[model samples]
Target chain A: MDIGYAFLMCSMLGILASIAFSIAYLMGSDTRKIVKKANFAISTFTLLSFFTLLYYFLVRDFSVRYVFLYSDTHLPLVYTISAVWAGREGSLLLWLLYISIFIVLSTRRLDKLDKVTAFANIIMCTVAAFFNFLLLTSSNPFVRLGFHPPEGYGLNPLLRTPEMAIHPPAIFLGYAGMTVPFAFAIAATYYREEWVKRARNYLLVAWAFLGFGILLGAWWAYKTLGWGGYWGWDPVENSSLLPWLTASALLHGVIVEERKRGMKLLNYALAVVTFDLVILATFITRSGIISSVHAFARNKEAYAYMVLIVLSLLLGLVVYIKRKDFFEYDHSYRLRERLIQGSVLIFALSTVTVLVGTLTPLLMHASVTRGFYRHIEIPLGTALVVLLGVCVIAYRESMLRKSVLHSLVAGTLAGIVCFVLTKLSLASLGVGIFVFSLVGVIQGYSSRKIDLRRAGAIAAHLGLILLFIGVMGSWMYESSYTNINMGVGQSVHAGDYTLKLNGFREVNGNAKFDVVAYVSVYRDGKLVGVMHPKLIIYNLMRSDRIVASVDIISLPLEDIYIAMGGVTPQGVASFEFYVVPLVSFVWIGSLLIIAGGILAALQRREEKARKGVVDAEGEG
Target chain B: MKKLSILVGVVVIVFGIALAMSFKSELCPYVTVSYVVSKGEVRNVQVNGTIVPNSTKILPNNTLMFNLSDGKTEMRVIYHGILSHYQEGIPAVVVGSYYDGVFHAKEVLLKCPSKYKVAEENYSTSKVLSKG
Candidate 1:
């Protein structure tokens, strides 16, 4: 424990040394190897201490209470080693170490960019040090209680799965990667206008991981959480989503500035705000702060740590802007009048609303401010159609170039399809819009060749519209519940189908008690399929939850999603009997959305490459 | 410009309709334990209380202990976390519609009166917490 504290203290001191060197260098001092060497020293000691902690767990060192309390004698070796990141404080320290290592790498002398990057690393390290300071004070995992612990409490059962590794790490990578865009933007802000190019790579890196991270989290929830749906609009989920949506807009917004020589200041502001929201998201998730399943939900220490980081960055950003004069080109009426322009403004406003919505809980907690303000993500819809709307203008002469009268006639036809599909449930508001989009697509396709990038963007938007309709259908219409103590071959009517629970079988694993209930789905006295919903009692949490593993009978029109999450007395498995209409559209739409992201990224890369070749007098 | 109006009109009209629909039946996850306790009715009934075994359970599972409290009366409770309650010492307001004899916890929300918040409110809540 003493060694652990000492090692952590050493790293904190290293951060100080780095900061000292940074201050000196900024004050125009030469020969700053002292701070660089100090950083390396700090990271090394921190790494060593971290390894010592890991090594102790692996060897089953009964003396260390963390090991005794968390690790079992029969635990697998992989879990034992990964056990380092399994606790509240341990994970904080691990992430801190990761940030430090990232700082060290980014700060190194890379031919020409190192000099400019030093400032960015200093900011990154400052953020990292706040975390280290928390570890050194409040929540040290290495604190000993003197008495020997017999066996370590295992990892939380929900967190012990293979998906756990991928989900949390991907989120961390995505969240942490946002700092890169932040760093380069700050650094470039202090330089000549030519340095804007330096920030593009950071933007791309942040965008890619943010996409992957959000996708991984969604996938994890779909597979493991036993929830019949994806994207529950949870506050923490919204926190991540806010930055992603804003950054997606900025990604396109920045390209306009990069290529068409417009929206430069807008791009810079978006970069800063996106990074700030990352801290806010961290605050929302870590601060026991809000009522979110994604968050740890009881840690005030996390909140304090995040607030300090946000304040420091805000101060640093101000210091940077005050130090340099960034050239701003006017957003002329021609550029400002465009649909994308209004779209970007609405996008930013929507981002602000999300930030406000997320922060509302923190405000309400103290009884400081209150009123009914929620549903931040909904405002993004304002600009959603705007993007697709521009595609018409951008590709007007393409294959779809029919007169306005054609859409009026075609839209009426498309509305009928939507109305019929929804079974007359009054949520037919999607009818008019879907019809218009359909006509737009068809007309554009029929008249001229659609630009792949432009066409893909429209298709993706059209798909999103489909997704919205699907989500509404599932959320409002779906109904399900649990079943307790039933006789052999007991039947229950759920929504539209009769389910006969045939039998229960007990299955044991290395760590969980599973009661699998086999149910036969029948309609009109015809046996259609058997769905097995498992009730798993995990050893780690020593609790029972239902994992309704239904043999999903998927159809083109409707999907029968049987979900189980808990066990009942008398060998009954608790399950949600649901038949969601157009459930498959959700996944299919998401894939199409991802395909759009890929195509968009490829489009940008090709554009950049061509620009690069052109700059070299078309030498490639 | 024609396309732009159509898109704007579509988004505004659709979202306007959604908001309008939502007002009739507010579907939200506000049915959390704490929210229920704050606004729901209090009734006397038996509940499965997994009174948390605090510092003692930090040891072994067999040496586990729990405290059963209804704010007025306290008792010893010992059952596995089958329908586990959150940590004890928390002034948890359990919310449920009681019938027969059981005060089944339809939801359990724990909100300990914040000593820190009180202090912060006396001075800092307006500045920091007000616009949080």
Candidate 2:
């Protein structure tokens, strides 16, 4: 066995030991010391194995089969590092690393631990061991090639971007981090009320990372896919959205459970479902059961993930069945609380819709189009925005008149803006609701003395509104001018902008040969920028593959997006230009949401410990 | 409370019906060129086929014209979009329909075959063919 394989074996052994010790601790044994040591050992061995694999990539060890498959001598240092997770086996290792790290973090402060924590530790250890088992059995990265080649097959040319390098790990971190909440949910069902408080931060971090990961994926798609749109409702994309929607709902539902001791069972169910969706996402992306642009491969490893999903759901159902009293709806909510419940309900329904759309292909051999999602989700999203506005306004005592007046004013202003920006359509009403909610958030924030959680909520709400506006403007008002064949120094009018093709040149680099076409974007007869859209030919073993790189100029109102289709032999170039409006808001809004999530996750320990007392005397 | 529950039930039923309708309307089957040819005049279908070698050319109107085959049947395809990942003999899923003896493709999806469980023998062969 090689060094990497040896390290992974040790890691697997440590995981198995930790599982045994944690279970023994759960079964009235004083193996706490052993459990902790085993946990630490698992972390250390996994880290060592991970680094050893990275070492293989860095040294360009073609003798290692994974390195031989994904890395080459000519790859940059950063990409060489990313090449560690560029394949199925290495990414599974990355998942193991995250699981080990989270396992240590979640079980760090436990002594005289309750049965719940012990149970949680056991579940977490078992999960880590399960993934390790997968690595050892099916998707091991340490297989040897027996003979070192002169060079290796390079990483996919599309995945050589900074965003692509970071996307998979961010997504895997989100997937791995979700186990803490799920384990806590199952453990808390064993008789504890502390899971809501304990699992909240883990849930928040996973939800935030998942959101940011989806954003990065969208951004990368817009940049590299040469398509004018970001989210294409691809099955894999829908899989990621499935967990995000449920987790978002669960995030809100836990607040209810923590505060009012209501929706406890629902919160547990959400946690379980979110975790299941994470596995489902993995299965869809890897199984090739349904075709997606991000297909990994159909493999036995995917079947293992599918079994894990079923077992997780079964475990959740058993716990839920055992704890029937937790399902009692004990408290009548206030108007604001009810609105939040409505919003959560909408999120849950949207999750169901997306799940059906995603799985329909596997069931019926027919895929649902983007129209299917938009037709249902847009109205649901609009209702959510309206509920958000009303929910914010309902925080005050005299809300009816103030809310009506505020919503009217925000709606009128947003209507006018939408009318001027694009054509006034039914979507303007949705934009108006977004603006209403945004204004309500601003007003509520300015009027009240708030804590970090409240401020973070407001920031996140504002960010969502901005993101909604961005989605509405970009998807609805987007226009493209394709088949714009131009010679050098030729200018053509494309909507509100003029695209002047200046020249073409070729450059041969060590990794890629680029044929870049320079085009000057002008608005109102003034030069905005010289954008160079390139046709990149990545130098690969035995062949070269040509891909188009998009050049975008982010104007104040619209982005001038250009991609060169091809350059003819006569020096004439064909181009596709897109005017995408308010696309920057998607990015800026995503950053705000992430920052808000992080801010909320980093709440003071005292604040988190402050539990909301249930007033039994209140009306039910 | 009972009346509210009834109202919610009605609203849910109505919404579910609408969702089912939209889903039915939006269902696009993934098929092959032979299936499309057999069906004849199929609409809103995704056809998977291999790009015929040396069959790709830019038409006079700047649209891309190529021949797509599924080993048995080959059909002409007219695509308006830019497909930077197109390679001869590589598998592609084209979303559109077959009508008037030609497939008018709205979108073409091509993913890297190296990532697949299936061996990339076709990809290597296409590379060799391109070189030749």
Candidate 3:
């Protein structure tokens, strides 16, 4: 009679209904009526299940085991809702809900192609069924407690930030978005070219979301984790990067298959790899086979995930073997084609390297350091930048000797300027190549008639150049770890600024306490605003958890970051200061990259519409 | 097109060599405290263990010294840097070398324990107490 039981019953009904619908679709039944109605019903029930869980958290219903574990009376309303996906069971439900909505939207779009839509629905529903089973068996959020507790244990102190509310959902959306493309890839194995075209827009949307999600995670780590650096090449982070890399390769490979009818098999394989990697990422974070900061507690759901992955791989292998000859293309290769091929190859190689590095710990029982990753990534990244420069010059045309010469000169000149500015040797060379690519793309865009598709590619390439420059400047030439102890009115010099401890204030919140430090900064004897860095301690069920807050003064060229250490018995506060150069450009470049991806998706939609009109005219 | 392929092949080979060389210099393989104790005073090696509770001390020069234990063996670690907020009895990884029976740590990374570990323990204990 409880809400939890009702929610569980609804979810169980959804699973059974979807399974029946999938069976009907796979049997070549006229699934038009069944598909539409079942998709609507399943999506509605999943939403209701999610909302029911949310209702429990909102009402402080500690009788439900999940609500008791993650929420308390003192927790804020926003985080109360966010805590719905903060743990294992609730996050799986969120994943199921997103996939159900995707199935409804995608099935609606492919209404004209009934057979292909039916096949795609079978694929989507099977995925949905797997998650539903996991939720039902191992990770059911609807489980209840016999005894009612007066107060609930609160959310993890580390996950109590504003970014925690957005980060998980963005990542889950990225993971769910890939399912549409995977379904189309399965359809492509049978229907080939037509399905590939249909899958392109979905692939772009997924790639864009994944990239945006990654940037948001990096921002969260940089701001909340109190680490001066953004990326640590953690196992969980690398798991997400694996899919993004393969998806990037697929994004380019599909273009080749679209224009030249080549790389068809590669595109299909990339799609499969992207989806498998998404599931693999989930497994890696949940299984606890590897140590990661983002992992949930070790659970039995890992076995379920592994079984799903193995079955998917076997199915993909069978399909690839059955239709081996369908991927053959007879067109002679061209320069532009070769450039695209090179980029895809580089992406594939990078993904392999990261995958090996990330899994090495589990296989060999030895962990590779972040330094090992940088060794492979930096040189490979620099070469990719150089290749992008060549590709921009060779866009829509064969490579010309004169253009090559021009690019070389531009690169060298830019490199020299960068060397003079930053005084770092190899990174200057990287900047030089980036600037050369930027110039080439700009020239190409301006010389041609306005084409949004090509413009989107150019914008993305430009964004990469900016991102490379920012990373090089910050990583190669930054001052850090300058610890200074100062009392009120005592000044310490760091980089080009003077930091003076002004005062401190204590903040007592409902669930936590904070000691906020007021530090004044001056540049060239000009006063800047006061920076408030805090040390926070949260009241949990058993003990208090401490977290440091970073205060950052961001500008176009650099950031002045300060983290409060603590106060000594002598009344001097300890602070760590870092002057990171050109880091803002990284965020700016990320925005540009996201914008370019969205622009490209819009252009694809327009192109598809135009093609539909032309086909109709020809039929007439 | 063949020439372009050849050009890419050459670039990949060159980058591969550079990557391999960089890997050699950047390799920081983690060793256990027992391994470090057996092989004394090795340079640029990492060790992973747990920080012994209440064994931490701050020196006059602002350096921190603590005992790092791996259940069976314990070693002293000296770190000279800004110490972040870290809990006692948690897992930690120290990046440095062993010298004169102590770990001269260049950096110390503290790992967060599973939040549910305590809850699980409490639940089991309460159940046992009720049965008794």
Candidate 4:
């Protein structure tokens, strides 16, 4: 039998085995042994299916329709591997593969086998089966071609970068990781005792992966797209951001629920919303219901996916309504509690704003500008930052009126100082508030015993402060569009530097061609370095095959960027130069945020272990 | 705490609605050349149409002039920036205003048609053979 047929057969068998396991679990049988054996088999089959597709690409098998469409013989080995998830069918298959891996890993982490675990398993398996059915019917990556062409179409030239290769898989890992939390949220409705604790680690893992994936995507857009700006508030980008906002809120809500037994329904709602938004994001990107740069072609599979999303939402609502009485809590008047509540509310508001903006194009056929997002996010973000400062001080000092006043005075004074130093106008006030919060949180942690969770939260808040400062500084001070038409030996002065066009060279490759511009930079009449900005053209693609290569000179305070537009017939090369201040801090702050997440996860694991030991000691 | 929560909720909703209304004018509506011609000089709108092949010209003041069409009606567009290398017959989104029989475009975005659709014909084989 052919490899494609073999792969399809494997998926079909995996689905059958999963359904059998689900049935066995529902029948109150001993499901531990069945789950263990079935997980291994299902994982193996999924891995084989993925590798079978990869082998076809590696061997330049044009008889495979997917390979013929996305890969050419001239593609490098690295890109050939990257081509695995470059298209709609292949990406869905990749999603299936990642979901399968997550399922095996999560089931292995189950400490005991009970109805809760079994039900969670059943839920996950049902999701897996749904994906398998879609793969079998609508988006099979293993379909074959009756006739083979001599050469296959190459991958899109815009996606030829190294970052694009890893972007999709990282994002899919994030989307698949969210399923674990959704499963636990459903199980929480049944078993109320340990579900929150059980779901904590899974939720954190998903949040961290999603955050990291978004950072990578932003980086990819910066490096690959010649737009000079990282984010465009595009519909696809908004789709990703929607889930991220809800997931962040869920993270905060989980903490509140664990500490005070409040916001339980809120936490559950967030969990369901985050997962549903992930599905909605996939639908937006796949269904062609809204036009986006990232969407695939319109397909019939969208209707099936929409049906699944609506059913999941309705089911979650039913469960939540049925279990409403279990989640009631006493009202608390504590300042710290109020701050947490307010922050969650703010996050929800921002989520609604972005959701409305994103769906407007599809629902009303109207486009929301980047300014709308900015207007909503700026004031709310500033308030959230100020609230963080207040919360840290209040939490440390028992929420006293005097303590609150002290923190406010300190924050305002710091804001004025920042205003004088940075001269960032109104944004400097936000920077000041963030700095005060960072300092207060650090002080609060330092005075007490060094607790890992507390320290991680502080670090994460500090990272957010830095991110705000970076964003404010860069957005307010960026100067660009100093377009200069220069030939060899012609110099143009922009900002504090003089750019001289040194020369140009043509680079010919197997699949594409590049025109590299050699430009020398001088500051105060002293030579700094030569910058090479190129224009790359792929000969295969029919439209938008040309990409500008940006050269950047990094400094502590600012980055000097240059992009070559094109060379005229008269040997005059036009270039666009920009001086973007404090942009590196944005990237550095994101790394800190990711690091803090890792630290938080590790500390949570430690806390769980220590609690387990303490409980055992108490019993003894 | 109940009263406080209610107050905060009201403030957030009021603020959100107000901000959204204030910025409603900034939203750019996507239109076609036919719509622009029928509407007669709308401001701050977006136009999506295909560029007429061989109709692009570089003006002396670094502005680009091109004829855009929606397969039925055509309009002249003037963009005050360097035009990127674009496919001749594919759709491009121009964001600006229609004024005085010309579309004053502030931004021009080329659509990558080949990214979404399959290749119409296999020219790769012949190109590779020729190169070899």
The C-alpha stretches of model 2 lying farther than 4 A from their native spots are A287-289, A292-298, A416-423, A542-544, A606-620, B54-58, B81-88, B110-132
| Interface CA root-mean-square deviation for model 4 | 7.3
Write down the C-alpha DockQ for each prediction: 0.04, 0.34, 0.21, 0.31
Superposed by TM-score, candidate 3 places the C-alpha of residue A112 at a distance from the truth, in angstroms, of 2.5
The residue-by-residue lDDT of candidate 3 on A1-620, one tens digit each, is: 66644665575576567557756766777656666777777788888889989999999989899999998998999999999998888888888888888888888753564666677777788888888888777787878898889999878766777776787787778788888888877766765535666677777777787888788878877776655778778887888889989988988888888888888888888888888999988777555556642233355676677788788777778877887888788768677778888889889878977887787666653566677777777766776777787776676564455676777788899899979987878777877787777776765566677666776777777887788788877777778864687887899988788888887777878787677889999999998768998877666674435566889999768888888766654556678888888898888877787777778889977887899999999999
Tell me which of candidates 1 and 2 scores higher on DockQ.
2
Error of 3 at A507 (Å): 2.9
List all candidate RMSDs to the true structure: 10.3, 4.9, 5.4, 3.9
Q: Identify the CAPRI category of the predicted complex in candidate 1.
A: incorrect
Top of the candidates by DockQ: 2
> How many Å off is the CA of A170 in candidate 2?
1.3
lDDT of 1 by residue, A1-620 (tens): 37877888888888888877777776677535765676687678778768878887887876776676556665678777666766656666766776676666556553432445667767777777877877887767677758765665655444445655555455555566667667766766665444346555455555556666676666555545554555655566667888887777777676577665676666766777777777666555545456533343455576575677568567646845675355456545343235456667667656655555555445543111111123434435523543443345444434234434566566566667767876663445455555555565455455555555555555566666566556556655555443322445788886567888787677767765565668888878888788776545545422212223344677785777666534433333345656767666766665566555556546656777889889899564
Clashing pairs for predicted structure model 3, backbone only: none
Kindly report the TM-score of the first chain in candidate 2.
0.94
lDDT of 3 at A442: 67
How would you order the candidates by lDDT, starting with the best?
A: 2, 3, 4, 1
Model 3 Cα shift for residue B81 (angstroms): 1.1
State every prediction's TM-score relative to the real structure. 0.73, 0.92, 0.91, 0.92
